[model samples]
Target: MELLRSLTIGQYVPRASPVHRLDPRTKVLATTALLVVVFLARDFAGLGLFALFLGACLLLAQIPLGFVLRGLRPIWFLLVLTLLLQVFFGGTSEGTVLWRLGPFAATREGLVQGLFVTARLVLLVVATSLLTFTTSPVELADGMERLLAPFRRVGVPAHELAMMMTIALRFIPTLVEETEKIMKAQMARGADLDTGGLVRRARALVPILVPLFVSAFRRADELALAMEARCYRGGEGRTRMKQLRYRRSDALAAAVVLAASFAVLLPGRFRW
Candidate 1:
């Protein structure tokens, strides 16, 4: 339950701030651009610049820093494992060896590489989290549909895809809660989930997974029925009560992200 609650990626927080007020399309485009630049970044300077940028966004959104950081908790194990793996297994043999842990030699280059890769991943998650934090799932769907509409000429189901993505994000918390309940129920029935070898642990998951799948399918069917009852059709004739438009601020937001990406990424290419 604690692990599931730590997932903040799909959660939304309402705020009356510039970041939240911007057109969702602008936010979507800017986030995509930021992610691209983050992946293209070569060194710490670029990541630092992005970290600062995201921090500023967090402040503008008036979201608690603790809430954003909480998302990192669930992934702590993965991060530590990645750090350990890179420390002992990554980097070339010609690099400087820092020390040895058992039979594994930790290299200076590997440590540096591990830290860099980890920071990159942190930035990526924070960026996406910021987007979902400021923009509601409905707005995200509309923005995605609009952005993907151009591809409709080539037979893309923009509305359908956007709707699916939005529904998935909105249901994350619900599914997580259901999973927790199922686990607890099984635990009460004397199911040994924690104390087990690797294979035993894998086998234990079967009970949890079976019920979860059934619950998920049941929910999906109910949702489908509900939508059908409402005569749901998001096609050519569909109209929205709230229309999305691009304003000067939207243009400025995109320009700012592009400018920052160049400012950081271009200079980032020439590194130590």
Candidate 2:
């Protein structure tokens, strides 16, 4: 589906922007901090400040606003569903009712809750997307492994986990491409993937899914063989080709994110 391809999550966009040039570890840490702030935000004022920060980050990254927003297309249904549930089923019974449908009522508190929840979800997605957008799969893996290295003393397989995550992210676009190919092939063979009710359309996907799964397995097997042939082993004693180093820019970026995090909390603290 075209919608699937529009998803920018886990897809790196090569650019000569400050955000992209920052150390991957900085981006990872910054993203995590912002995610925490998103959840901590309690009102529109807090969310608006964070939204402005996010917009600034997007601008610094040189990413088109429309491209960044297109990632939300596939999740529109989920967003709408969440809002509807919060509007009708949320809050106490004492709030002013704005609308009523049968026994369900939309209250003022419910509306505020719905909007806040929706904004949080959107901000979360955008923050995560920014991380993936700026960092390449290899860089992400290296950064993740380094970040988790301290836990190695506790017997955590940090390198292996990071490698698995890298492989998964790297294959997202590949899998999407393969799916598109299979869909086109099926259509060419007179297999209808559209023009049906929800159930029927889902049933129509069987033909495409079967071959896609087979292709996925075949690719995995080939990757395993290639790795084996190259004598690849677990991350024990592994050395990176390009070691990650934090620069002055990275420190500046981290400081900015920290300031923004504090700003996000201030609104809730002061109730302003």
Candidate 3:
């Protein structure tokens, strides 16, 4: 649980901007469309446009740039690794040679491929960050439940899945704070967590994990009891305290996303 807390990405800063006011479903669909656009993009120009689109969305969402980049920090190493691998191990076909080293030749095709792939991944992550930052977990889960209502009849427990997701998202920040507190408490007691070798450090985590697990189970037990005491059940005719409704803003946002999708797909001098 402690390990999981530091990795959570569900913390949203609430705002009253147009993006924040838009329905969660609209933001979700727009992000999904942008993801598809990133993957379908074939050249640098298309990738640039996709990045611009994401930037505009982020600006509209009013999420802090520092916060978004901070969230991306944990995966920066992986992104670098992937880019390096692509640059060297990519390109199964011949193209203009850019560099010739001992046993490897870097070609234009490989360079373009690697750069485009990295840009695509960056755009995807940024777009998703925008979605999560703009939409609160409860709103997201509620929107998702309503969006997935049609699947409820095909043996799909849509409401249950959404409720589970809501709980998990809602608890991420709380758990992260708890983990930090526990680590600090242990450190104050002279626990040497930072100066140990790999194996030794792994063994040292036992104390942290045990308490984390105990606290997590205790919280879950209390939550279950509270739910039962309130006569809570599954989504069987359950009414929401704040029901989600799609307004003109949602339609406008959807229209903008569809237009952007078409713009990305349209053919012209930039066509690849």
Which candidate has the top score in lDDT? 2
Q: What is the TM-score of each predicted model, taking all chains together?
A: 0.90, 0.97, 0.90
Greater-lDDT candidate between 1 and 3: 1
Put down candidate 1 lDDT per residue, 1-272, tens digits, no spaces: 47777788768899999889899999999999999989999989888988988898899899888999897777788888888888888878888999987878999899999999899888888899999999999999999999999999999999899989988987888889999999999999999988879999999999899999999999999999999899996766899899998889888888888888887798766664
lDDT for each residue of candidate 3 in 1-272, tens digit (9 for 90 to 100): 34544452556878888999988878877888888877776666666776677778778777767777777777888888777666666876467777778788777767767877777777778878788888899989988898899998898898999999999997777777877888888888888787779998998787778888999999999999999999988999988798778899889889988887767666423554
RMSD of 1: 2.1
- Whole-model lDDT per candidate: 0.89, 0.89, 0.79
Q: List, residue by residue over 1-272, the lDDT tens digit for candidate 2.
A: 57667777667889999999888899999999999999988879889999999999999998888988888887889899999999988878988999899999999888889988998999999999999888888898899999999999999999889989987877778889999998988889998876989999999999989988998899889988998899899887888789899999999999999999999898688865
Ranking by lDDT: 2, 1, 3
Clash count of each predicted structure: 0, 0, 0
Which lDDT value does model 3 have at 88?
Answer: 67
CA deviation > 4 Å runs, candidate 2: none
Flag regions of model 3 displaced more than 4 Å.
Answer: 1-8, 93-108, 268-272
Under the 3 Å rule for N, CA and C atoms, how many clashes does model 1 have?
A: 0
Worst 10 residues of 1 by lDDT: 263-272
